[model samples]
Target: MAKRGSRRATATRQQRNGKQEPPLAGWRLWLKRTLVWGTGLAVLALLFLGVAVVFAERSLPSYATLQATQPGQTIVVRARDGSELIELGPSYGQWLDPDQIPQPMKDAMVSVEDRRFYSHFGVDPIGLARAVYVWMTGDRRLGATSTITQQLARNLFLNSNRSLDRKLREGVLAMALELKFSKQEILALYLNKVYFGGGAYGIESASRKFFSHPATHLSVSESAIIAGLVKAPSRYSPTADVDAAVRRANVVLSLMREQGRISASEAAVDPSAVKLKKDTNQNSVRYFTDWALPQLEVLLPDTTEPIEVWTTLDPGMQNAASNAIKANVPKGAQGALVSLDRDGAILAMVGGTDYVTSNYNRATEAMRQPGSAWKLFVYLAALEAGYTPDDRVKDVPVTIDGWSPRNSGGSFAGEMDVRSAFAYSKNTVAAQLGNEVGFGTVASMAKRFGITTPISTYPSMVLGSSEVRVIEMTRAFAEISAGGFTVEPYGIVKVTTTGGQVLYQHEDTRKAQLVPDYVAAGMTDLLQTTVATGTGRAAQIGRPVAGKTGTTSSNKDGWFLGFSSGITTGVWMGRDDAKPVSGLHGGSAPARAFSAYMKVAVKDRPVEQFKTDLKLPEWQMEPDEEHMYGDPGDYYYIDEQGNLVEPNKPDQAGQMPFPPDSEQGSAPGNGQQPQQQPTPAPPSNGRPGDNPQAASDDFLNRATGRGGGTTQRTEPRQSGPRSVTIQPTPQN
Candidate 1:
């Protein structure tokens, strides 16, 4: 026994040390490795799945939380000056109990939104499979099949942004909803809370908005229309398009018949029965509220209690912005304006000339080419890459990939300094800068400047082929105005519940610097020069101002973005259909509107000089011989050498004769007459729009902001800013 024990001990020691145990053959060795690796992989997969599950379910609200939320709560909005703007919400209609809801309404909703409402849990795997198949086959005419519970989940807790994780969370919430409430309760919740567009929410409000009645009196055809709206509220709202809404209702009716909820005869829609209400929500600040409301879903998704929103909009500035658009925008064309403070507060926003005629928020929605205003990004990129505003860049004509950008002047001048090129809005120099720095680098520069829109790296993109929203473009200039820090446009300042509970407050903190101080100063130099003696001269208001002008292809879109008096404003004028307006350039009506708006908007704000480091060449505004009969402020550039130049002038006898800020009023936008315009420039080559000039004497006189001032330079204001209902408190 002792001998056997010794032998066993020796074998164990050898196995540990690597000798006694014989190695397994090929199959055994392979099996051992497979088992070890398989176990490791399995552990890793489990860990990853656990993390994913936690991430997906992290933002899900509890069933108790959802139950505690108040229904039909009103959203009250107020402007910066403490005046109420509007009250909007589902509370506009009467809330109905489960039994109070019409049977046809419930049936129609179930038939069109979810066919298997009674059979499936919150999630319907069969429906999901069918949707997947439809998606793979590219046939989406048959809408998605989110169960009533699933729809409740999203409507209650989630926003409109779609993502894979959002879907997962939705599924989990749907299941939780099914576990917490009965199917009938879910249906009632959906029918009451869903948005039916046309500023209507809840079945009762939608019924009144479309058919001038309550939900209880809605017919089967009306029920079908309301059900179809769930798929696309704006597209099917009868108030928006009567014919489309009627057609969608017929489709919903057909589905109801297929589901055995209605007979074929009842499925047919009667166009005569669909009567759209002409009385619209004509709230003057509706554009601002509509834009700010969606942000609430993102900011406080955890709560459903109605809240009061404090926005950054200045009523005076808003009025001035609207009046400017009306005065400057030609008939039949649309215009938008966005004004921002240095901290990114949206001081004023005008989405269109008349929001009553068109509710579309063009200031925040329309994406159009920025034209020469896009040069800001190009020049900013170059400045950051160690190029200076004083550096020489080629402006001679050149083509790339069969595409060549032509200057608005129709010809490119020879080599010129960066500041001169940017001031003159030279297209060739911008294209060359884009190629030198790489188009990708230029795009990155645009992104850095707060342009969130997608930009293609094609050569033409250097010339502003990419579309960008007016608000974002204004935000980009605000960044530069903010002394090189990143700026993000924000409208809402604070939000509080009806019970005075604070839900959200905008935090004021310093943002990351997007560019060095030197680069931003260089950009400022270019912009100031543009407004001082370049294409953006019309935007000047006596005091030093910095701005850029943009005119897209065929004069389809005109823009003027400028900053002064610690305020940055962007103006866009274009046709809604993207069609050309005859002879519209950034310097024409758009700049005129900017001139008029800023003159009044900044009356109370302090005048701040933009920072610049580059030593600009001496230049002066000399009277032009050709435009001698034209309006004053026409001028030509004459260098110190006494030789006439394209865009530069010596500051000798030809110094610009602009009036001081005090001469007009004590500050910008002051309610007083503007001083005389700068000595005019001569017409070069005996052609119109071919001469370098300061702002016309008439435009400089009319440049005003948020106060009482004359805006009539070429066109007069037909009417003042639109009016709105000021609801001081939410109506219960």
Candidate 2:
């Protein structure tokens, strides 16, 4: 039973051991596989948790510390007494209190830029996913997931480089900004920081540029148009292409409707109804701007600061001046006008007929001969030289150093008083007076009057041969209008920061006594006479006015410079090439234009006379005896008997009073008259009665005769009574 039981036991044991061992091996293999799989699952779970942590960290708000540095942008505008006229800016940025921005504009911006802007915390997950999906699908859409806060961050803290890294940075900055600032604050920043083209950076500038109004006044459609430009400003720029801009605006309207930001009915309205104000390029006042530029800089030394320039210019006046020249200027002619206050404050200046055609600034840049208008200086010099208006000067042909000047009509009056000569523009009289007063003296006076150019003391210079610019002449004449106080014309009155910080203020520091008040007054009187009755008659404005007309030689240039109490204006008309203008004269064209302009300019203003207190010296004419005659060919006579004689008639005995003495020593009528008889040949010693001696004494007595005296003559009186007595005349 041991052997048999052992064998059975061995088999059973072996079976059992084999079974157990297989189970153990199987258990080991299963354990090893389970352990390996479990470890892998744990590792994978940890990895996923780490990735989720990273993504969640990215999704959370990143509080980036931004350095809010405002870039330098200047807003230049011309204003006067609380009214704005011309305005220009670089990077059209305008910072406004949130309250100042129209609610419609804000709503439009949110609707177009980011519909979920108000709800998002810097990152819009839905919008981001959509953008990613679109990008992955190769559509390459730029509808970023960035909210307004994020855009503000990108504009404020990040570079504009469009790279993945930059985008991430933008996103991080945006989140940081959102976490640090409220939604309203972010919107305000974004609205002010975004670029709107044409050097405009903010909505305010863009609004003003496009609508010619403030951002606070933007209409719903106007707001929509501006919001639409943020995507691609140049593409939607009203100036670049209005049609394209309108189309883009319509798309914005559609987006607004799709987002429920606007009603479907509203979106259904005609796209044409979304009227965008025309963009004016802000160059209409280029000439005016250029003119005001230097003054602005001078007024505000720090141009980096925003400032307002209070000017004297009225937009209406400027437009009138511009249009007048444009309408009247010939096709080939170029012209300019400068209107200013008597105090030298510039009101309006048109440098050229059109700034687009040329910015040459003919009003201030062009230098040309002023023609007879310069004769005023000659008259002024004469006034200073103790010459009176009534003093007569010969207007006959005159030559100086071989130079003979002719009048405008190539004729001359024999003699004319100063007023008539000046009125008629007699060239000879002007040249003569200029010569007498000394050309250097006149030039010196012109210098005091604000002429900067060198004036040569040549005879022709009296007739305006020296070239001078319109500005110089205008300013010079303004001194006369200002009652002899030299004035420096300036366009800028004051400059200030956009925030109302005063930067600079112009001082009337350029004052000097250019001429005596009385002298200036006299000249003004003469100029007034000119406008009233002389060549400048066309410039008469039915009011107290003073002016001068200028027509350069060859009819190549014409000018009318005049002033009323409140303002002085100068107008010039001529060909750009300096060629002759047919039938053109200052009195005909420019004077008429001047009168027309002044009539409008001074209509509402009070009459202002030059402030002066000096008394004028009285002027009187000098006598000329040589010219007092009837005829050079006529004759008159006195009889030998001391009786008056008539012309072309002979005298009888009684008409001749007494008879001639005979050679015999007695009167012819009575042979021996007691008194006439040779009283007695006194002393024959070669004295009174001696032959040659007596004759010499008689001649001496006759030559030195007193009331009643006698003399002996041998020569027969030609064509009248004969004298028989002969007398020898003394040598000495």
Candidate 3:
């Protein structure tokens, strides 16, 4: 009994100890877990507070030191005499105050680019969160998650390269901008800095370029168009893709309506009614500008300001030059025209008939064979080689070092004066002159005339077989018109800063005398005679005109280069494929067009005189006179004294024989009296000369030299004895 009691007591004590230990172990575990979790939560809270402080500090504005470099801006083009031609810009970032920005444009941009732009402080946390979510979902690409202030900050201080580091930098800059500027100021900066396509950077330039109106007057539709361009300028450019632009513009309008910036009715605005008023020469003058820009750079070597180039382009003249070509040239025919002043200032230049068809400016870019136009250089060579206008040269077939040149008509004139040879466009005579003057002399003259191409000292050079640009040719001819002084064509007049400080001015310093004043005058006289009586007769104007007509051998090219007292003009007409123009010759097509254009070009200008003191050599007949008078039997020869010569009498003939008019009856003194010669019966059988009385009347009408004067007969009567009386016989 005593042992059992002791065992029971021990078992109970052990049980009690086990129960207490279980409760203590459970309490210890609960306390440890509570302390650990509470400490971890406190640490996380401190970390969050630190991150917020850093973000808040970053949101404060920070100032940066800029070198104050003037923005790269538009260059204005002016004429030499200080007339505005055009303005060109890569970015239209014109600075304007925030108040100047139209309310409609502002609201439209906000609605389209960032709806919560004004409410956000540079960084849009909600927008960023959304953007992150969208990125995480892989449904949208990452882009700027910033407000207007942030965008302005990026534009002002950040590089354009897109990268994570750049994004971080942009965010830092944006926060700095927000701290520095108020929402209104930041919005204004963004408005002025944003690009609006069409070479327009700011709202002001965008307004003017698109609507031809000021930014202050921009309407909802206009604002929407501008707002749409922010996403993809090229894709929504009104000039580049009108349809896509209209669609995007409508999206902007819809956004405005959705954002309560505009009424639903306003959002229904017809996009079709929107018309983009673009500059007349949007990018069409890029080549001309390119050519002019280098020159401007040279002229204003020290200029940091934008340059203003003034050209003498009469818009009327330029339009006429362009339109005339478009209207007259064939569908595929490419042509160019260059009009310039005597001082080598290019007034109007038509690079191609249609700039939209092809941008290959035939005027300044093409270096094709000048053909007979090249003869002008050859003539310059001849004059330089001591040959005069009256020098005689054989137009008969000739060969020079196995190279024989044929006349244009394929028939030779046998022999002709130098002037007659040039006027008549006798190829054989030109070739002979080239040989006489030595091809090297001609090439030298061409070089002096500004022909930069390599010229061969061969017989073909006489025919302008070498290639040259229309600009170079026009420049050369302008030197002739300017009385032998070589001139460099200039477009820019002066360069100035936006603050009206003069930066650079084009200096006309370099000049060279290519020929003597008299020589230039003599050449002008020859060209004038060409307009009056030569192949260039079609280029004649009421005023004093001098010009040369050129027709390539294969009729593949036609050119007319001429000058008035104040201006020199060059015209070229040919197929782009170099195919021959049918029934087209320089004397007809190009000359006629040149004459037409000059009539208007010189209408108000005073007539100028060419220098005329150049010495000319005396005329001398060739040694063999037989070849000159070979065809003496065909017609009656007469002396300068008006005395009739016997048939086959070459020695007494002072001038070439003249064929008698059919209405003048048979031979004189052949038993035919003037009154009884059957009235000189005209040609019959439906021929042009069928009407004898009509022919006589026509002759009588033309007989009067001046206006409305009666025809007078001036025949000398013989007072000598043995005056032979001839009986008159009537024809049936």
Candidate 4:
């Protein structure tokens, strides 16, 4: 024991003198080596991360553009009063301050999206572990576990491509963003940059678009609704599918309640009661904006700069028109309505039922046969050719070029005056007059009034066989409203940059007279007979009205074009595929739609008479005594199909196929009786106007919160005695 102790002491003494080391010293040396290696590896990892960050920072989109508060970041469209109408940009909404963000909104987002948003350092380790487990098992439907800061980083500087490289780069960038921006700043950016659907790119826009209120005023339910859209905006859009949207919002509310962010009572509000205000900037607004967006370049010369456009759209008128169509038109059948001032400023335009479902602006894009509506140009040609409204015209059936034109009611009124013929929508008179004036003259008259579509010189051109856009037809009618002055339709009133520098200002483009004032006066007098005592009686609004009613062969297209002194509107309804509506006719849906819209549009505006020099043709006013139908009620009845079925007995095979409603009667104008058939039962829906089966299934589903079924609402008041219904022919 003494030798061992002496040896150990000597070894210690020798170690102190730099000779032999103790046995345990080897373990100490091994630990030191391990520490050094680990430190070097850590240093290398950090160095590599820094280099990668530098490279990624260089590859990012321009930082100034990303952080810009104007132009590239948010392009705001405004109403004339400087109210924001819409926003167009990848990142929209006001850049809210951290202090300005409501706590409830933040809490709801955090609870539903990332509970550790405030706690995590750019990335959550636990979340990463769980994500790995999910990914390894290929259960990708579990969604992502990215932190809010990380999402901001991805939204700002990262491509959404999924790859290990992208993920690493994202992680690096997320850490960098964390270092650069404080947590509040990061949260603010995230909130401002997130997409909330319905073309809204930020919380503010989403709130305004959905609730018609600003983000600062959003209620707890509203905030949850907006928050729930972060995952799939289009799928969860309130406008697209209200039930789905509410269901998602309920999920968010439940999460908030579960996380103790809200009280149970606060979450107990009925989801159905969370009524979203109807969006005025929907399809109708989009139609005008889309037409005006391309004009921005011509107006601005440099579209790169942010600009504000003042359009001619009257929000009140637009809303009225949109509501009118929505309230009156049945589902499945597409309808378009346009309201214009005499000078051709578009007051309102509704292109279709839902712009999201179908962007094809029927008012501007579709070109369909104008049916009897085309008779305006034909009558104008006849007037120019020295035909007076009182002149007697043969109403016997006539066929031109293998095409036989028939009126809505299949009977002929023989030897009726021109005014009475037009009032009754007599097909035989219209066809005969077209032949007399020459199709070329009629085509020329239509062109002079702004009908730019190809006008064939074919005889059927008199019957609106060739297609013309609704907008085009509207413009043509405006010329007559302008007292023969050519009116150029325009929507944009002004364009200016955000800095208030004017880029474009509207100038009246009304041109010199395109039609003789006398001709216009005569035509107005003739058309007024339509609204006063003819097929267009449904469109009367207790004022002087002049317009035409139109229905095509097989009832495929229906139209009503009428004008007061202040506004002229054209309404068209039909299937997109040209399928015939079961019992549809011009005098039904289109006429009532016209009446419904005008009744609101003309409110508060002074009622004025159409300016026309009533140069007495003296003879034009004489009622035809010979062939006059006994009573208006005897002339028509609402058929099961909603069409006005005339009881005209068929003539011999060679006689004119069937003449439309005859003004006088069947034989020579001496008060002769016409053959007739028993009237059919009216539509079972009790209303002559409503298409019960035409309501949208999707709309009904959302309204009732049941999938795959429809509910019927009571028929609205009708302006006429007959209703138009449509039945579609199957596609090949």
Candidate 5:
């Protein structure tokens, strides 16, 4: 039987190879082998895919954790009344429920991001197939296959990385999210967690940022525009690129119409003509927030938790101060104004002309010469050394170590009381006073008052040659306003965590007495004369104010540092390069700016009188009546000519002919001509011999000395006389 079977097989095989068999027999065998190999390869691909899915699932976050994903919130800054000042860190606006989102906005997002959002189980099989086909075909569009839930999974769990591994991981996470949450929940999380441009973190913040309204108020066109920004927030941002945003919005609208979310007619909504709400908190409050940020770091160091900061900033005063600077500061010139309470609460601070143009906080960072404003410390040193405001000081030409410190106008009224000297901002008198109290004493006073800049013992130190920051000067002045108590200017009042836990609270703990009550009173009275009869007259706000005007040599910087009972303010104006501003003086722009700010700052506040009880000694009688200018009464009413007119005394018309107003511009202490004298001369006690003409010529020549006039030195025949002229003194 085996032999018979073998014979039959051979015969069949022969028949297959012969003409009697079908011609395609060999092709059938090849087709069977190809089928077997293809099936084996398909099973291997399935096994590899299953292994990749398992690995991706292991890499994903837990289901419970994914469902509970919440991004870190923004730090909220609030004004005193709980009104939002600004937000620090990435701001996430209010989160809305799934149904709270507008229908059009949701539809637009669905049409552009994922048309099969509702039908997909986190992963869209049909979309995935289409993507694969397109990718295999090398299509240029490179459309994404991720459903909205898949996008949410990537945004919430995965970082922005374009890799095959991340794609696989994202798919696994999307599946996990779909199992743990509903479609609406996924969409809500996606809308709330996606990052938008310009520091906006979510849909609501993006809506407010682009349209200046809540997400619920977004129109269909606006929704389309917003939806288009999801792919590339910076490139399609309406605020950043209007035309790009319009193109993107049109694309989104077309897609919406194609998806039947909107009709063709409705898709015609004009993106170019769309009304956008103006962005709020753009620059007005940025200055304050910028300043407050450092304080937050100091108050709460190395913190990642969202915090609420209650600041001492007065929004009303901030707006007013900012407006005053914008309105009053001259064009092309920048300005800084700072206001504070007696206890060092920063009320309002305008750091520069515009925070957008420059973030340099001139008010806090600029350390320019305080000019005569620095005299406060010098006089404070004098006061500490038992020098009274009425103590006599010579306002004469002074040459200390080859450096001749001339008065502003170069003309010096003979001897005057310390009060008048400071009020007038006499450079010579201040130099002499600083010398009498010892340079160390003056420097120590400055350090105690928060002046951190290096101070030289040079005679010019008394003339405010030492540079100082505006905030430093303001804080020092606050010490005087607070009855000689130390004041550390602070903005943040309290900080709390988002969970209602108090992190830090500011306390008025600076209780150490920096200046004695008596010294503070004397200083306040002396500075008051500066505003009352001195260079800071322009800063007078029809209230009991005390201040000083300071103009650096050549007008490089101008400052009006003043304080009332309730508030202390400092104003500074100068070019960034420290180049002299033409005709700029402390009393002109700074004093006027201080006045303008205070006018609105102290509105409706009851004016309180400054307490002046530190009794100053009586004025001394004139030593040389002929050479020395008369007392305050004698020169108080000088006319255009050098004639001194007795006030309300018609009979006493010509007691003594004074120098012309040109010789002695304004009062000694007013802002218009700070430290500006008509001439530089010898000491008050020593006069040039009996030649009155020589003295008069010397005064006029010295007054106009800056203008090509030459001066000659002449030694008095007498040896070691008390006073000496600009004429070279005897070398010894």
Candidate 6:
């Protein structure tokens, strides 16, 4: 019976493909099946790994290319005078021989990053096992699986994006690198390629960036601190956070002790006591370089070569602009400044108080309400419609389709010349002018002036309700300085490869005359009157200056656009969130930045006066209006004696000239002298504030007194009466 059953089973395993099969029993049969499946999988795995390796090898550069490759390439930016303003890419310090590398630094790096670096071949199995242990235990911080050699391979051959495919590729490269180079050679290469943050690449750059010394001069504490940065460069950067860096360095010291790289006594050295290099570039010119970087791609579309950029930036003016913005921009508020020549060369641009803290380039990127600064377009449009600056415009209250706009002081000065009304930034007058000239004409004027931002035709649009960039505003003012010719702001003088091949040279691209000469003269007369005795009086520099002051009704955005010393400058100040800033007024801080920056920026330039067909007669608000407005930031206010009084002039009344009865009119500083300190005054320019965001769509309602949302109030920190402001609420 058993023989018959075996025969039946054997019959099932009969011959196939003309080959007879022999029957096996128990473990033998199971072993045969296992061998077949295992061999197939092994062949597939080998094929997959081979293909991955081949793909990785194809992207690898030749040895010469690898040797020549910088962890990052640098672009040297030179100012107009050919002096170095800043280096635009990763900072690479002097290359060192293996002997020049300090032993302590090598020890710190190996101890913290890869203790088994020399014993293992690139991929450390022990470290990977620990990673597996960490993954299972849900302890992320304990798993640092990358070996030093693996890091070198990734830095040399890959990008920063993390993925499983990249990891597998990195592992293959690491193993190949181990075979091609000795342990010492790999370590040296790793040190030279790793990023150490603070714009630094390589160990040598890190040593100098943090310690202000070369790697050869580094002490054990400094070495450990620099070594600690590789794990998380920016977070552990001494320049960014000294406390965090010191804490990380302490951890590295403990690692060194565990690895026996340092004695217990040596590990006791206090890293916190180690003096680090101060950031010498607190006034970073990165603002200029950042603006110029993308332009290089446009200028040289075909080259991967590093280049030298000769910029229009004047180091002196850049320093001045940076200092002015930093000193004048109040705490919690941000400011941006752009200075351009009449031909539109950007001499200096400060995008914010500190580039290290926030890199949002407000000068070129932020599109906030220009306040009365936009009136440059409005008045220009009026001029285009044949109204002279001498023409009278009503400064009294006006209503347009149920939208009633009032003057800043809430008391209009009846009738005034167009220049005076503009000088005072009269919302009613500007709105009236827009209504007469046609909103389409206003939009056309803005477009002609290089303001590419979308302009709405609402009645309130005349009062800078539309948003524009600081650079665009400066360029528009520059065109006015250029006698009504269009000007486009340019920063790159030329871009050249390091080998002296010129790639791009800037040319005067546009000379289009948008407005007639008569209009330019009229606008100049108005701008001069503004600086001489209007809202922009704070910008006066004892010379022929033309400027305008613009403060949104919400006191959220302030602007000063002006021309002087053959240079046109625009300044903007506000919180990024569009929330109301306390005491923010165009006549105050923005003008102060313009003044501070221009005073030094044009100090060496020849003084030039504005060419005007008519002289602007100085005008002041009526005594009733002045008494009612009573803002220290106003250009001129009337005294009880009915005389024009300068609020900032101590000689006018032996003290500040603000109204004693009003809340915002208190005399500045001990009531003995007019304060030169830029006071945060009433930013309200009397028009309903620029509707921020979705609020913009509701501007018609808010301006016409239909619907409104709640306003965000910042506690008053500036020395002034609390600002009374109104605007359509912010949706962001």
CA lDDT scores, all candidates in order = 0.74, 0.66, 0.65, 0.71, 0.72, 0.74
Give the per-residue lDDT digits (tens) of candidate 1, residues 192-303: 7787776577798889888888899888999999989988775566765577788999999999998889888898889886666775666447778878877886787566
Clashing pairs in 2: 62-176, 91-199, 91-201, 92-199, 92-200, 92-201, 713-725, 713-726, 714-726
Better model by TM-score: candidate 3 vs candidate 4: 4
**Superior by lDDT: candidate 1 or candidate 4:** 1
For each of the candidates, the C-alpha root-mean-square deviation to the true structure, in angstroms, is 17.5, 34.7, 27.6, 23.2, 22.2, 18.6
Cα error of candidate 1 at position 421, Å: 2.2
Which one is best on TM-score? 1
Q: Count the backbone clashes (under 3 Å) in each candidate.
A: 22, 9, 7, 15, 22, 0
For model 6, residues 1-732, the per-residue Cα lDDT tens digits are 999999877766664344566679799989999999999999999798667666665766665566567866578888988888877577788877677899998999998899999899779988898789888898756565889988999788765445788788788888777766778778888887788875788888888878877789999888888899888875577775676778898899999999888999888547556887877574558767877866775676555457788989988888899999989987799999999987788899998887766656799999999878888987876664435565555566667757888778798786666778888888887776676555666776787677788888787888889999889888988988988777888888988888998988888884766655656888998999999999988897877899998999789998998998789999999999899989999999989988988899888888897887832211111223234323444332322212222334344445445433233345445655333444322222223333211112233233323343223222211221111222211211
> What value does the lDDT take at residue 387 in candidate 3?
43
Ranking of all predicted structures according to TM-score, beginning with the best and ending with the worst:
1, 6, 5, 4, 3, 2
Q: Cα RMSD for candidate 4?
A: 23.2
Name model 3 segments beyond 4 Å from true. 1-71, 80-83, 91-287, 301-307, 609-613, 616-732
Name model 4 segments beyond 4 Å from true.
1-73, 80-83, 92-283, 614-732
lDDT of 2 by residue, 147-259 (tens): 78767766665555567987776676666566657787778777876878666777888887777777888877777788889987645777655666667777777888787
**What is the alpha-carbon lDDT for the whole of candidate 4?**
0.71
Model 3 lDDT, residue 644, Cα: 23
| Model 6 lDDT, full chain set | 0.74
Q: Per-candidate TM vs. native?
A: 0.67, 0.51, 0.51, 0.52, 0.53, 0.56
Candidate 5 root-mean-square deviation in Å:
22.2
Task: Name the candidate, 2 or 4, with the larger TM-score value.
Answer: 4
